[model samples]
Target chain A: MSDSDFSILGGPPSERNDESSGGNRTARDDRDTDADPTPELPPGDAATALHRARLYSLLALGLERPDGNGGLEMDDTTALVNAAAALDRTVEDAATAVDDHLTDTAERKKRWASLFGVEEGHTVSPYELTYLPGPLLTTVRQLADIRGFYHAFGIDVGEKMPYRGDHVCYQLEFLAHLCLRDARLRRAGDDEGVTIVVDARRTFLEAHLGRWFWRFAGEISAHDDGFFAAVADLLAALVEDEIAILDLDPEWVPDTSEVTEWNEGIFGAAGRSCGGCGADATGLEDLEGSPGNPRNPGSQTAQDGLDDR
Target chain B: MPQVHNWQLNREVEFPYEESRPERQWAAMFDLNKCIECQTCTLACKTTWTHEEGQEHMFWNNVETKPYGAHPIGWDKRTLEDMGTMEWDGDTYEGDTIFETEDVDWDDPENHPTEERINEDVAGFMPDIEDDWRYPNLGEDETAGEEMDLDVHFDEDTHPIWFFYLPRICNHCTYAGCAGGCPVQAIYKRPEDGVVLIDREECQAQMVCNETCPYKKAQYNPAETISQKCVGCYPKTEDGRAPQCFETCLGKIRLHGYINTPEEADDSDPMAEPTNPLDFLVHQKEVALPLYPQFGLEPNVYYIPPTTAPVDYLEQLFGPGVEDAFETYRAIGDGEEPALEGLLNLMGSTEWSITAFEVDDGEAVGYYEGDEVGRVPITEPQTERDRVDEVDGEEVYRLDIT
Candidate 1:
């Protein structure tokens, strides 16, 4: 493997010290680089963090609503396949399934529309709160909390993309953003910055995205065992891997699926109603350059996602 | 124990910390008579500061309907019970304060709190997370005394059964109980404005402040494993702007400014020169009284005791100043205290903090750092209309005319 391609799996120092950038390493060869590495694996942690970030970004882009252009490009698929192979067999298998199921652009677009889009009334919901239980008044706090995480990092939603902060795409993108920060901070040799970003990522996953992602995967898989299903599987596999890596135990959402009333008796159906796009009176505002700071997208100087600080 | 002068008690009170005062104390006054308990202040505070996962139950600004309503149910009643029977000898508190109740010598080196051990001797009960914080507005709108009867006639101050809205926030006391009781000394009063805050980094999650604060403003965040409380909206106050809760008050019941003690009180009346409005209302007019002065924390926030509530109940809550405060409040309506009336009128007129104020040529003018921020009429304009008016050769009775 290239010096930049770090193995995500926990491997021995001897194996990591071997300066081979080959992606065809066995499961036993590619173990955790997240833990404290030997002197030989100094760049491995940074590379691995960036690697995980790329995969997360790919998954986020794949799940988001199609922007007229056909979603999930072949190059992205190739990258995903390579990244997944580096992580574990299960993820690689899921990524291969996604690659195999890549259909025609028009067909893929139509499938995405019917499943996650409004065509089928979002048959497979990509919103985190969809799987969660309780009244909107009670649960809407999570929505605020999600926005708070974004705000704390000075991340705001783009004006054009009005998706809710709790959207699967946004959550995945947030994770990607955190991982990117982790990589950047690691490269800069800022341990404190790395700790903060990593801790934020762990807590955020436990509190928000991690809690409801498996349910989303289940919903998507139950609906159709096709391209979207494979994508869902990829998502599930990546998240499961991360959960294992982080040693997190997220609180799962309820089993039953029910779309709550638009108003939920809060605004009495009089004021502006929620359009299931995370835009409501009590919902998140358009955060301008959310998920990550667009101004300094890649530049990390120890203060990643700590703009407030 | 370190003895500090508590002006509200008009006596020296025992405290854990030495007498170290901020440059200026952050304080606000709420006219209980004008409060509607709309919860706008509560929501504003919630959205501004405490909308996180663990802070779901927290309301930094809560308007509880007293004599029965309380957030975290019986927060005041239970603390008072623990304090036992506190008496007011004239203006001096005759009973033990919250710090003095347990009789733990805070001056002793052994009693000093560290990260390892909690100061269990702090005189207050630790509220259960689930049971105490479950209901934010328990007994909402519930009244006390005799039940209301349809045939019974009552006036503004003559109601047999009564309830008044009591909006609460962090008192940001001169001798802050949270700051005093913190094991690791995580909680501190800002040297600039006296805004008490729990240092998130320094906090060891001992949760001592949660139990020690008599007002129960200090809250534990389970998600972050730290104790949190009102930061007194120091960010806004730093820029000479009112806090979110103060600005969002719909009834115009809140007046935000810095307060001074009676000895250091501002005497510039504002007619000739700029005068501190908070000092004028809290000290000069003596219309507003601190809530539970006998607690001995020397809380900064003051309240104009509700005219409708019973004198005895008001006395217990606001100490012996309730009757005098009510008298001064009534005198303003009777046009006896013109300057006080003008200053009260200036409240809630602007979002900018009123550092100084003046009554000038039939108008109440508010100022922030010598610049005029708000101006309102001392008396709202009124006009008398004729009973009958001729409209297109037809007589029209002006029934709704003032």
Candidate 2:
């Protein structure tokens, strides 16, 4: 590997020298003593972050509709394959899937439209609001918040491009921007810029992308078994790796009761009773008219017992 | 109920209620001959409004290729098919309006078709995204008629296959079918400028408006559970500015102004006293014709039909007056008619409302907010430059001081 590539993957030269010299002070370490307070990341950490950023950029470009010519350039595909391979050996399978599945520009465009475009039965929607459980109107508020984030960073959607603020490709592209910015700041010794970029990345990942991406990926994989499915797999892997790197707790907590309630609400509350066998639980009649009472009657043992009585 | 004159239907139609007309009726005309389908208007409108979630597929200003293009994929064909063929006797059109075509019991809200029924009956199909239609540009740029052979030369007598860009928005009809079809009265036409709007809070998402609108301008926002459409940028228009689409047309093919209604104009010929540029073109010159006037909505938006398109097809779409309108347009293009020069010069006159206009010398001067914002020349000024020549691989350039 070249010196720059080695430094990007392994950390700065001083840190590597310190490690190789068995914790002894090296000539380069003398100069880096003042810079040590900022705490340079290990070479492995830097390499991982760079690799993740590259993967994100690749995915973002891959998902975007090709410029003018229709499909992605061979160079872009090759770079994506290389980046995925660097991340994990298993990613080679996904790279192969992309090559095998998405061949020509026209086929790619058609597949993209079918999967993400507003088609008759689009397999997947790229918007975050679709996956979130809420009234459809409330999605506007979420969109505004996403736009606010973009605006804060001086990034505005092009007037000509009609795309939602929370599109998956856009979100991924934003993350890539943040990572690249952080990398530049690190290299330039701009500690403040680095900190700001890193913090923004973590906050964005935690609040927005990390919230529904796993579920979105699962949905994509379930619906599509082509290049997008492979993309989904890669996305899930990247998000998980990011979460670990950021030292963030697992974001999604699968609530069976919440899911059950949601399903019941949608499909109808038949073959089920309200509330467990507890005296405090609101009765069916009480819930029917009482505005202050909880809408959902958790569990059904109490109603079942009352029926027996 | 108020009786309104629908010139296209050549009869008086009943409105929901009689209300005093706005001081000025907002109107616009687009020249299809100059439109290049750049989509500048579409983007301008999108970025200004409808950038929110649930509005992802909405294109209030869309330019679709005629003959094979439609935002909602056959919006015109389906509505025309349902209404059946229309009859034309010279300049008069005999056809059923949206109100006359199908029986929609507006009084009984519950009996009205549900979203599913409306989708099936009115739209005749469903999009993949539930309650949301896609393919705004489906079959865009696709030409109708037989493919030309590579070696074939053009024949002067025979018409060639062609397509025209049709930039569309809310017509803001005097008698909006969307407003009339809304069971809950969620849709309404403003008494001020005759702009149509949907009240989101009151909308029950019955989607009857979507189904009933012949133009299919009313869109169902599934997330919002309401039908929304082009509000005609009333907020901007009220402030003496034009709609986003009108303000940003790159082709300079749009003209915005207020036209005197038949009831308001003192003269029997409304064109006799043309206070604004729109009045001059739509009334005096009669170059621009309303699209599908037979629908009887009395749509405010007008169009200058493409000269290259078949005359019969153009007549079928715009009425028999289309031939006259085309003749006037051709005369204006050839600079043979000075009477229509001011109207042609007013195309893309100003970004704001043109309250007054006058033709001076060869330029059409438009007054907006009591200030002259535009002076469109009847003939654009051209500058000639001498070409540089190379002699024996040496560049020879000619320089002109004046």
DockQ of each: 0.03, 0.01
Model no. 2, DockQ: 0.01
- TM-scores of the candidates are 0.64, 0.54
* Chain B TM-score against the true chain B, each candidate: 0.97, 0.85
Q: Give the range where candidate 1 chain B is weakest over 10 consecutive residues by summed lDDT.
A: B130-139
Q: TM-score (chain B) for model 1?
A: 0.97
lDDT of 1 at A268: 34
Write model 1 residue lDDT over B235-259, tens digit each, in one string: 7787788999999888999999999
Distance (Å) between predicted and true CA of B240, model 1?
Answer: 3.0
* First chain of candidate 1, TM-score: 0.68
The sequence of per-residue lDDT tens digits that candidate 1 reaches over residues A137-243 is 45667888898888878797777678888888888888899889999988898877787788888889899988888888888888888888999999999889888
**Model 2 clashing residue pairs (backbone):** A10-A43, A11-A43, A120-B128, A121-B128, A275-A299
